[model samples]
Target: MAKTYKDVKIPEELFFNIKNFIEKYSELGFRSVSEFVNSSARNEMERIEDRKRNE
Candidate 1:
């Protein structure tokens, strides 16, 4: 099955910041800003879920 995706917009300044961070730390293995953002979003979702479960 094909995976579906959607666009999520962020402030332009924050986007540039992530771009710069990824460029500076190329060895971290993030291929693009979108990849980093996706990973960060997923991590945050898990963290929030865990916190709620513990409470």
Candidate 2:
């Protein structure tokens, strides 16, 4: 699938928390909070699909 950007609205507090995580873990591998969020979302979608398939 081709990638296109979409704008998502998250609460300010959650946004700040994610940014803080990115800053703290930058050395661990995450380049930015967006990258972390994207990967996490993709993994969650995969989990949902798998559960639906199993059911």
User: Which one wins on TM-score?
Assistant: 1
The candidate scoring highest on lDDT is 1
Q: TM-score for each prediction?
A: 0.89, 0.75
| Regions more than 4 Å wrong, model 2 | 1-3
lDDT for model 1: 0.97
lDDT of 2 by residue, 1-55 (tens): 9989988888989988999988877776887767888899999999999999999
Span of ten consecutive residues with least summed lDDT in model 1: 3-12
Residue-by-residue lDDT tens digits, candidate 1, 28-49: 9999999999999999999999
- Give the clashing residue pairs of candidate 1, or none: none
Q: For model 2, give the 10-residue run with minimal summed lDDT.
A: 24-33
The per-model lDDT (C-alpha) reads 0.97, 0.87
